[model samples]
Target: MAVSRGCLCCVKYLMFVFNLIFWLGGCGLFGVGVWLSFTQSQFSSLPLSFPSLSAANLLLVAGGVTMVTGFLGCLGALKEQRCLLMTFFVILLLLFLTEVTLILILSIYHKELDEKAKDDLIKGMKDYNKNTDLKNSWDNMQKIFKCCGVSNHTDWHNSTGTGQLPSSCCRPGTDPCHRWEEPCYEKAKNFLLSNITSVLVFGVCLGIVQILALAFSMLMYCQILRAEKYMD
Candidate 1:
């Protein structure tokens, strides 16, 4: 069947919009990842825990990949280049598969992952004062999360050998308050775990978008091939 000119025009416009959104999202991710990487590098001298550092590095990689793929997709869609479209489709498909696999693995080993994260947080807390960046990071987390230590306030004592807690552990507007009884670990952990669903949802949604883009690209490529044949 012959593809209508109107249908082709619509597909072209739709793809342009989709690719534009994808490109913007990629840029945002890349910018945030770069920021995190720079922040992490500043604390290289500290005994930063692997989980935190690894997370930052992962962000950088993800951002870079997203940006490159987004550019390819935009270019392919705009120029109607079959080779670029195919390349975009392949990369998007691979990313989709990888994301699904990662989700499955994470679901299967959530408990172990949680425990590992706990250990890393404790280690980071123990070496917090060793580096300025580490100290600032810990303080900011405590302040923002309204948390104290990995497991409890006492964890700070066990980890730092210091009887006094950082002021950030105190509740806001009560700077002089001496209530070290509050534990931050549970709060921080809960906060993080609560957001996991949203992240997963976003990833799944993005994967679906990629699938649509792949299908559109492939269809358009075929249409282009047919058009060229008709011309010849």
Candidate 2:
């Protein structure tokens, strides 16, 4: 009984520490998701759904689930409650499955999604001048990405019905002929792709953590049951 108690204590603290780290990671993910959502809101006119916005939404969901799971795990470990421990395990299992499905779908439809996003962005460009929010967003994106229109500078000509490119399309004090030749869509796509990759990696890591958490929770739950039986 003494050895069992010691072992249980060790496992309890281990679960607590693990969950604390998990919760912190979830907070970071949530913060990044919120930032992305705010920045991408300017492009809301593009489409109801786009890669960056979708990714932000994904992050928010994943983060919220992770935080909830982490909290359950932490409280269950400290209180040694079988119900909370089981709930944590169930939640983690569901979250893991959901992540796997999303990743698979994203991998399969990546090209199609990219094309859709490009089409949407190009379509939105037509209203660039007419929509203050979109215009500012485009200008901000161009400046940040150091790129011009969707496909290239010429795209603006069609969208604006004017040959003049926005000043954001070129470096300050540079000749108009020297406007950025890279497409804003490509740059933005690449940026979002890199972030998605990071998210994928993070998801895998979190899945592993969840598996460990499940193991720990079950182990402690069984130990608690055994201790109660011993007392009886």
Candidate 3:
């Protein structure tokens, strides 16, 4: 069955929001990448849980690139420019690719860190054996570690005391035998790091969908133009 131009226009109009948001979100993600590229310290804080500087740096780069490309996509959407949308799609696809790898690295790191921390606490406890405060201290250490699960990295203090410091564990090697190796809420921070990748992936995928929609709309518009010329 033949579709009327009016019907086609209605479909495109309905898709407008989809196109608009895809570009806007894409741009924001790209901006993050730019910010990370400029500030080494911020980059270091990122992937925020990975020990390997390389992994952290890579995530930062991915983020910055995604952010910039995404922002450009937003501009293209606003302008309703086809070539620009295509360019933005390429960058968005790259962003998705990087995000996939980042997810793998993150899973590996999280598992490894969890094991290492458990081993460290166990060994530390054994070393303190026979010190009358040993059991109490170990128990307290375990408690502090558990406390860390609830907190975020930003709240952790590099302090010997957990007093008023959120997520700051018992100062490691110190008595009451407490210490924080990283910031408090190490788990939450790791979750946050991984969460970004998940979100960006979903966003890029949505952008892809929007691009497909735009492609169809552009094709329809071209067809209409051709049909009008032929009739004339």
Q: Find the candidate with the highest lDDT and give its number.
A: 2
Each prediction's whole-model lDDT (CA)? 0.68, 0.81, 0.48
**Per-residue lDDT of candidate 2, residues 1-232 (tens digit):** 9999998999899888888878877886787789879878766555645667777887888788788889888999999988898888788788878878877887899888778877877788788778888788788888788898877788888777887888888887887456887888788778887766776677667777777787888889889999999999
Off by over 4 Å in 3: 1-16, 23-71, 77-82, 107-232
Mind giving the per-residue lDDT tens digits that candidate 1 earns over 28-74? 55665566556545334433333445545655676678778878888
Clashing pairs in 1: 147-184, 148-184
lDDT winner between candidates 1 and 2? 2
- Candidate numbers sorted by TM-score from highest down: 2, 1, 3
Q: For all the candidates, what are their Cα RMSDs to the real structure?
A: 4.5, 3.2, 11.0
lDDT of 3: 0.48
- Tens-digit lDDT string for candidate 3 (51-154): 32333355456545645664565555455455665676566666666666766765778677655644443343333334535434433433533444223322
Q: Model 2 residue 183 lDDT? A: 89
By the TM-score metric, which is better: model 1 or model 2? 2
Over 4 Å off, model 2: 1-6, 34-50, 157-167, 174-178, 193-203, 228-232
In terms of TM-score, the best-performing candidate is 2
Error of 1 at 81 (Å): 1.7
User: Candidate 2: deviation at residue 156, Å?
Assistant: 3.9
